[model samples]
Target: MAQQVRGVVARRKGEPVSIETVVVPDPGPGEAVVRVQACGVCHTDLHYREGGINDDFPFLLGHEAAGIVEEVGEGVEDVAPGDFVILNWRAVCGRCRACLRGRPWYCFDTHNARQKMTLTDGTELTPALGIGAFAEKTLVAAGQCTKVNPAVAPQVAGLLGCGVMAGLGAALNTADVRRGDSVAVIGVGGVGGAAVMGARLAAAATVVAVDVDDRKLAQAEKLGATHTVNSRTTDAVRAIRDLTGGFGADVVIEAVGRPETYEQAFYARDLAGTVVLVGVPTPEMELKLPLLDVFGRGGALKSSWYGDCLPSRDFPVLIDLHLQGRLDLGAFVSETIGLGDVEEAFATMRRGDVLRSVVLF
Candidate 1:
């Protein structure tokens, strides 16, 4: 049966999102219907609203979510009705070359539900990141629902579905941050702060957080940063170098997608160190760097897509850590709001007023 649910929708670019009744179709083959309990208002959702992602209007706008499996389509085995799960956008196809090469995290062909959820008048709603969940109910591929312990709150568990997981994975998986390592994370937004938390989880010795906003820097300090650099007043690259014994951080994570921050991350790392780009960049932006420096630096320059996380392997583990109190996932939720408040959440997000304003269904 089809489900009618309230959701936040972006009808046009540069406009506020509206709460509307959306139609969530029944689970089709290889799909699952989720009863969303909570969804976070991520920067990516705002980007989608501003049409920074694409011109796909009438977009169903939330993706970072955790829910209970309400139903599963034919052949769905990993998850079933009544299961608590975090919905992920990347559902790896085992047959993809990346999966065949034993790297499912880089799966070339991740998938979502084949069917589309539509408006009452029959307009097809493009689900944001292919896992829209601002609604009370949403449909996704079975592979997208990763089962996790239900002891944790949905608001916290859902965070692993997107941005938080991406940040943590960038530090642990992409950058492979080792214990006692010196790390610097640029842009202390939700994602960057998570990288700080991840670095701490990985036992980094010195986690220096760099950002322009003092509020965000303060938040980063609680997350695990050994020092904070307000880039608006200080030279970020040089500050990181000074903090790291004048050689720069052993690993630098750039969570601000601007070219300036990118270059900062490029030069803020130690010789032969790692630089991880986890921030999303605008299409109009271009990055230029010295060719000589690129060779001289001599280390891996990597971009973490969803933190290069294999949801199936990482989500449950992170959730377990959260439940065990080893990770402070609850700290990420700045406040809880309803679907109608998405526009306000976007404003707060832009102003760096909150780490995340989650929508509670």
Candidate 2:
């Protein structure tokens, strides 16, 4: 039987999201039904509400979630009912070129529930990032569920479902941050702060955080940032270079998703140092740089998609680390909110007052 559950939905462009009755069908082939326990309020959710992601009206507006698998469709052997899992947007198809090449993180083909979740009037809703989860229950591809240690709280583990994963992956995977390396992360919000934490986990000698807000910089310090630069009043590039013994950082991660921050990351890295772009930018945003400087930089300039993470491999390990107190996942959760507080959470997020305001079911 189909279930009708309350979910946050953006019914039209540039409008506020509301709690609406969402109809979720039972899992079809290769699909699963997840009972969402907690979902994080990400900037991307607000983007969907503002029609920035697409014209897919009535978007189901949450993705960073952790839940229990309530049911699985035929041929689904990976996850069974009652398993704790973190929901991932990317469900790699093994036959895709990227997957066949053993780079499933770059999988060109990802899967989602083939059946649509609709409204009371039968209007189809687009699930944000293919894993709409700001509801009591959601339907997704079986591969979207990555099992993690159940010992961790759902709200903390759910962060790995999106932003936090992206930040950590940017440092660990994209930039290949290593012990003794010096790293600088621009825009120390949820994602950037996670990058700082990732560098610390990698044993980086220095983890410098740059942000416009002093509060976020302080938050980054708690997350293992060795130094903080308030870009609002400081020359970030110079500060980073001076901190790194006038050589700049070995790896600079840009998490602001703006041309200015990207340029800062580029100039703040040592010659031949890697620059990782993890920030999400709008389509209208364009980057321009000197061709000579590009050649002279002599290092990789990479974009981190979902933190270049393989969810199955990364989620479980991260959960274990969190369980052992090696990773401070709890630091990311600024507050726990009820489902109805999602709209207010957006305002709080925009004000840069909190790292994350997670909605608990």
lDDT of each: 0.93, 0.96
List all candidate RMSDs to the true structure: 0.9, 0.6
| Top candidate, metric lDDT | 2
lDDT of 2 by residue, 1-361 (tens): 8999999999999888899999999899999999999999999999999988889898998999999999999999999999999999999999988999999999998989999999999999999999889999999999999998898999999999999999999999999999999999999999999999999999999999999999999999999999999999999999999999999999999999999999999999999999999999999999999999999889889999889999999999999999999999999999999999999999999999899999999
In model 2, the runs with Cα more than 4 Å from the true position are: none
Error (Å) of candidate 2 at residue 30 is 0.2
Per-model TM-score on C-alpha atoms: 0.98, 0.99
Residue-wise lDDT of candidate 1 within 273-310, one digit each (tens)? 99999998987899999999999989989999999999
For model 1, give the 10-residue run with minimal summed lDDT: 338-347
lDDT of 2: 0.96
